[model samples]
Target: MRVLWLSSIACNGNTHSFLNYPYMEQFLNDFEFIYHPVIDSNYSLKEIVTETIACDILLIEGSISDEFKRADVPVVDIITKYAKIVKKIVTVGTCATFGGIFRESDYKDTTGLHFVKEVKIDKFKDLLNKTISLSGCPVHPEVLVNTLYAIKKSVDLQLDNFLRPKDYFAYTVHNGCTRNEYFEYKVDNHKFGELEGCMFYDHGCQAPFTHGSCNKILWNEVNSKTRAGLPCMGCTEPTFPKSNLFGTKKNMGIPQDLPLGVGKRTYLTLAGITKAFTIDRLEKKLFDD
Candidate 1:
């Protein structure tokens, strides 16, 4: 399969992240990249801009705008031209999937291939059948590779409401988190870089509700943010890059956001019960000097 990667109103973080994929040799053997931002491929970007490149998969890596142009050519024209011909269209980050952080500012007209922060872009409605969203600050490379293989084999992928493949998005970042035990007991981390408590109660952690397999799959196939004593930033959601990211927003003493499918009342009841008794092990540092 031939893949063409394009960027618009982006920082090219996704392209850099994909470069870190451990199995690049294996990935390259299965698919051919017609044009990539950094990697030397079959076609140079200049050539791709002027000519119609035969692409099996069109990978868009950033938020787009009618005004955003590449090599003096409108990005919309390039994307739309291929959207009609490609077998699959993968929007490869929160930016391309939901108009992400770029849309938060003056770029009001910037949008994803199919959405603008939850609002559907009617212009691309016709391409929804073939478009797949892989949302993250920088999407996990494995998920992208797996999705590509699935597409190659004609495997039916179940998608969520956001049009993300359910195989990866079905679980929250908390599913396999190292801090899950602390989360279950409502033990809160008061500071950064600690292994004893859940950062969700005090420090901002959207893992319980944010969809993606960060903890399950692990970043770089070894460690995740929570594993390294940091909070999950919830970069995959449409409302990502929320203000005051390090602090949890609360109503009275209760968190404004609860875990996915979890009710506020049930959470309060559980909080009350869990806080009443403290587990001795969780109060101490995992590695004491």
Candidate 2:
């Protein structure tokens, strides 16, 4: 398949991140890479701008914009040209899938391919049948790799409403966190820098409610943010970067967002019961220490 990497409106972090994926070497050999800004290709920006490249799968990165140009040619025009020929459009990164951090301060009416923030875009009717959104600040390289492998093998991936593959987004980050015991018992991490307790209460850790396999996949194959004493930032969610980064929003002491598939009333009741116990073993981040 002839795959093209088209970008616009933000940092090319997804491209950089994907290049470092463990399966990158395998992907390089598997696909016919037509054009990429960072990777060497047979086609140049001049050729791409002037001619319609035959594309099978289009991998678009960065936020979509009308004004952004490459080789003095509008990226939207290039995208449209490829969109007509490609059967699958894999939008990598939150910028291309959901507009991400760029739309928060959009100076050029920039938006995502299929959805603008949380709403679907009527213009991208082509994506209705062919779009696969891998939304993350920088999409997890394995997620992108596996998605490609599945496509190459003709595997039918179950996708959510946002076109995100459900296999990765169905579970919350809290599923495999080391702080599960602390979170269950209602023990909270008082401040940052200590990897001892859960960051859900005082800190704005949205692992429980946010759907992502970050903790399960493990970034860099060594550790995840929660395991390294950082909050889950809720980057995968559409309403990411909500007002505060390190603080949680509450209403009468109840978190605005409850855990995945959990009801608010049930959660509050469970919280009250869980806090009633005093298990010293759960207090520490490590059991042996």
Inter-residue clash pairs, candidate 1: none
Clashing pairs in 2: none
Best by TM-score: 1
Candidate 1, 1-289: lDDT as tens digits: 9999998889999999998889999999999999888988978777888889888999999998888889899998999888877999999999999988887546558888899888887978888999999999999998888899999999989999889999999999999998788889887754675667788888888899999999999998899987787878889998877888888899897889999999988998999999899888777777866
Query: What's the CA RMSD for each of the models?
Result: 1.3, 1.5
lDDT of the structure predicted as candidate 1: 0.89
Model 2, span 37-77: residue lDDT tens: 69999999799879987878889898878878888988788
Off by over 4 Å in 1: 105-108
- Candidate 1 shows a clash count of 0
- Candidates in order, TM-scores: namely 0.96, 0.95
